[model samples]
Target: MADDSIRGISRRKFIAASGTAGALALAGCTQQNTGGGGGGDDNGSGNGSGGGSLSGEVIITGSSTVFPVSNEFAELFMDEHPDVNVTVDSTGSGGGFENNFCPGDSDINGASRPITDEEVENCESNDVTPVEFQVASDALTVAVNNEADWVDSMTFDELSQIWRDDGAQMWSDVRDDWPDEELELFGPASTSGTYDWFNENVIGEDYQHTAEHEPTEEDNLIVQGIQDSQYAMGYFGYAYYSENEDSVKAVEIREEEGDDPVAPSLDAASEGTYPLARPLFIYASEAAAEREEVAAFLEFYIENSGNDTVAEIGYVPAGDDVIEENMETLEEISG
Candidate 1:
């Protein structure tokens, strides 16, 4: 089902930037035959009309970080195939995959991080095989308040100290000479793939954030929260930070002492020097991809979103090799 969790100005800004108008329509969809017109009538007739008009609805749900790119793609795709209705929702990547995607509730799932084994097992239990596609790359950004003058760079050990169990409660606790002001921490909800990645990479996998930390699925909230607090620190996809650059400053990170701290940037993320840089993905159920409408949408999605649209959305586009591999994967499973 298409979800209605996003709202407000942030949602409005997101939609406007993604180039869609009106609120999303979230109803259970029924397949429509495209009639005897255009391309391969895996449905009926084959009449060429260039892009070939197609019909039917495709449901896309998952990571908020991936939402902008997907929404833009959906808008463009629907423009070309006006009869084809596509719905996109920004349920956190983990929640979408764990609850919606594994049960085969959505045709395509966007993820800010790779799918987990547990999610794969759940899909298998439900008799669904998902084909994976790499659509973009993102730097998991660690950001701080623009006024947090005491901060400059942080080592992984310092980050772990601040986020791990019974984590450091004040800036001074993280370092001997830092300010003693209380450190307000914000982060993604437990259902976010960004949350999973940060915990696994920064905090210990089995460990959890301190009870005092605030979490939400909305990255805009994290941006606002950090901006409002002088001693605050939070993290989200680089897109959020980039979009709100005036309110927040990205923290340079170092794996250890003696290493040069690197900030998140498109170049650093692309070259793999940014420690938190990772690939973004989309997963499609084998059953869904077999449908002509879903297949066409998926092909169109990668062809468009994998490059320029990705950069426009404030993330790195997939490399040429990555794009080719995803195309190969789509052909292999959907064919």
Candidate 2:
């Protein structure tokens, strides 16, 4: 279990601050929407041209890990500019690029991992140039059932043994003194960037992840599955775990066998002590940026990427330097 001090932040405050009371209405729903309207008083907060009310649709797809951040931003942005309709879909990073982003169907795509070469080529083939922005930091979290108190930390090797194909079946198989019960595994599907990072970083490319486990794009499903069985284990972005920390126990991670384990938290991730800490990103379509609404929305997103509200959402906020660089990139791409 993670320290209560590290995992106990309230997401309710973030919802109230963003003025999106309905943010938690759906637990595992794929799509989220901010209602659309036409012509409202301009607040000059959205960085729109002429300080007039901005009206247009912005579609964001990808990254269940980064979904909370983008979804929150969309709600806040739409609150300021009621005329703009914003919809966010958690299609997984790879799925978003292959299906919506590369196809030029979405204006922006959030990602937990950097865009791949193949995805870049696919986007270029369709004449869509991707402009990347670092939005936040995530501590990819591995968790087990709250009642599974026999273990608290796992080394990379133990994690690989448990997740790799044809690997450990029982908790005792990984360690001599542990229980002999079968290990029920739940995790993100292969399409997810979270899965990709875990596969490459934890599971290693030499072996494939076990296909025998339950896989889903919804992080809530993973949490639910782990909660139902004492032997069940899973991994996901820290936000979901933070939101439901009482329902699961996070496993501290050790980079090697002898090193001290580090718990996942905004502070650890920001300080680079968490082994699984990774940068979160949102890629904007250059052509889409030409649209006044899209450009304004992107500008707003970059400017607010480092706001304290992000930490309330259970991820490390971007730094001032990163936000400044993102603003510069947005200008270069959108101007």
Top candidate on lDDT is 2
Q: What is the lDDT of residue 210 in candidate 2?
A: 89
TM-score of 1: 0.86
Stretches > 4 Å off in candidate 1: 1-52
Worst 10 residues of 1 by lDDT: 23-32
lDDT (10s digit) by residue, model 1, range 131-199: 888888888899999888778889888899999888888899988898889989998888888888888
User: Residue 277 CA error for candidate 1 (Å)?
Assistant: 0.5
Model 2 lDDT on a 0 to 1 scale:
0.79
Q: Using Cα atoms with residue i matched to residue i, what is each candidate's TM-score against the true structure? A: 0.86, 0.86
Expressed as tens digits, the lDDT of each residue in 1-335 for candidate 2 is 11122111223443443233222211121221211111222221234443447898998888888877787777767767778887777788998899899999998988989999999999999999998999889989999999999999999999999999999999999999999999999999888998888888899989888897999887888989999999999999988887778889999999998999999887788889999999999999999998988998887777666654466667776776887788778778777
Which lDDT values do the candidates have, in the order given? 0.75, 0.79
Clashes of 2: 0
